[model samples]
Target chain A: MKIPTLHIPDGFISAPVSLLFLVISGFFVFLALRGAKKQLDEKVAPLAGLAAVFIFAMQMINFPVAAGTSGHLIGGALAAILIGPWAGVLAVTVVLIVQALVFADGGLTAIGLNVFIMSVLATLGAWYLFRFFQKIFPKNRIGFLTATAIASYLSVPISALGFTFQFALGGTAAITLDKVLIAMVGVHSVIGIGEAIITVLTISAVLSVRKDLVFGASKLKVSLVR
Target chain B: MSTKRIVQIGLVLSLFVAAFVSFYASANPDGLEFVAEQVGFLDTAKDSATGSSPLADYGLTGFEDERLSVGIAGIIGVLLTAVISFGLFTLIKKR
Candidate 1:
């Protein structure tokens, strides 16, 4: 089998839709930069760099999820939980840009589409979901991993939905919408499990040694009565 | 652990994964590409503009050994990602 191009390539979506997403993605990157400025102080800066490198490295490994299908960590959820949503977006954006420009893993024209889904949609969505779950779970290691697993799992399907939405708007092919939805969501659901496992494992690893580095863990409030 | 230690460990782990462990990754089409194929839209996919890059598809062009090609490319990607992201975060920290 040929080495899989891990991201959306050109011609999957129409030119107009791609350009539209370019503008949208660009705007989000700008917002991320502004927001990241507040969180990316001197101490957190190197951690952010390590997080991006780890993400890029992990994306290289595609584990087989099912027959004829493989999956890799998106790492958006992992980054968001490790750092924060804003900086997470920038990290993933950097990965996407590098992959596109250097490795050609993603298409040039489709860079915006990839960024919107992986960087904006997955990172922010996972962060918010994690925050919600954090309220329900205990403020401990198990609780943190549970929340990370749940949020990261859902984040993958959410990203799949992003692609489905774009394809519906401007797919170059004439595939049926329902089929596209079913196949995309079905495969991604399995892929999401891989994402969840990796995210949880990585989070737990860091939490074991340096829990202070995890942005999500830092937000956990300890009860005075407990 | 000190911040420097954490970065050091993380870097080592990342390099190991990208350079060695990644060589064993599954070669099957990923979820997105699988969906496109099963849904009859795979043909709509076109070559990326950088399809001919030396590092396109995560393998070094002109290298006969697939393992070495991919391994080297993975290392390059990790380093590039580290530099760009670190520079970006430093700039953000300053601003």
Candidate 2:
């Protein structure tokens, strides 16, 4: 059981496919900047930087699960909860760029798609879902954690679906959409549980520290929300 | 300490460590590579020949301990990423 790794290698995708991702990523960065601009007050800048760094650090500690399978923090939701989603998207995109260009973990050509699926899709998708879930849940710790869990889990494969579509359309390989979708969604769902747990625990930790910082923890402010 | 300051310091340190340990990563193929192999496109994966740098493919002249070499490569990656990211952010944003 392998996790849906965000790092797509080169030659696996065509130039046009990679270029499309590149353009999408650049556009998203612009959108992220605009979204972040609203809250980029002098005070928020430092916090934003801290959030970016936190994401970077957390991505490093990937946990092993079920033999060879392992999963790492894709903190898009956590970031969106604290900073706004646009800025959170930017933070994750920046991390991806650094990973590709400087770290060489991800391919340079695929940066756009990586940012699109992993950062933009993950962060924004998770934020919106969390917002929706927060409404129906019990509005307590259980509520917050459960919403966190569901949002994080679903957002992952949704992003993977986006990737599956992209790869099926523009992939260099001769694979079918059905298989790609099946394999991607299946593995990522398991990985999503890990993501959900990390998201819950990390959000809980931050909520305890500076309850003000955890964006999704808003309802928890009621002194003892479940 | 302020969450801001604590986060900044912690980020810098962690990035440093990630970069260093990246140099010694296990040679085992990552999730993507493993899947590519199983799915039948691993061979099609191309390298762009972007640089003349040593240690391409996480190997320094095709060393035997490819995994250790790759881990070390990962560590270096994080360091370079942190430096470049920190520098770019500092230079462009003027924060």
Model 2 chain A — which ten-residue stretch has the worst lDDT? A1-10
TM-score of chain B of each: 0.96, 0.53
In candidate 1, residue A130 scores what lDDT? Answer: 97
lDDT by residue (tens digit), candidate 2, A1-226: 1112337767777889889878987888887776676644444455556566666655655555443544556778777866668767877877776656544446778778788888888899998898888878877777777787888888777776877877886888788767777766766676687778867776776666666555455433544343
Candidate 1 error regions (>4 Å): A222-226
- Model 1's DockQ score: 0.81
Candidate 2 is scored at a TM of 0.80
Candidate 2 positional error at A192, Å: 1.4
User: Looking at candidate 2, what is the lDDT of residue B74?
Assistant: 48
For all predicted structures, in order, the TM-scores are 0.97, 0.80
Poorest 10 consecutive residues by lDDT, candidate 2 chain B: B86-95
Residues B1-95, candidate 1, lDDT per residue (tens digit)? 89899999999999999998888999999999999888899898899999889999999888888889888998999999999999889889744
Off by over 4 Å in 2: A1-6, A65-67, A218-226, B12-30, B48-95
lDDT of 2: 0.64
Best by DockQ: 1
After superposition on all C-alphas, the RMSD of every candidate to the true structure, in Å, is: 1.8, 4.3
Across A1-226, the per-residue lDDT of candidate 1 in tens digits comes to 2357899999999999999999999999999999999876677789999989999999988999877899999999999999989999999999999999999888999999999999999999999999999889886667767889999999999999999999999999987888999889999999999999999998888877777778887766522122
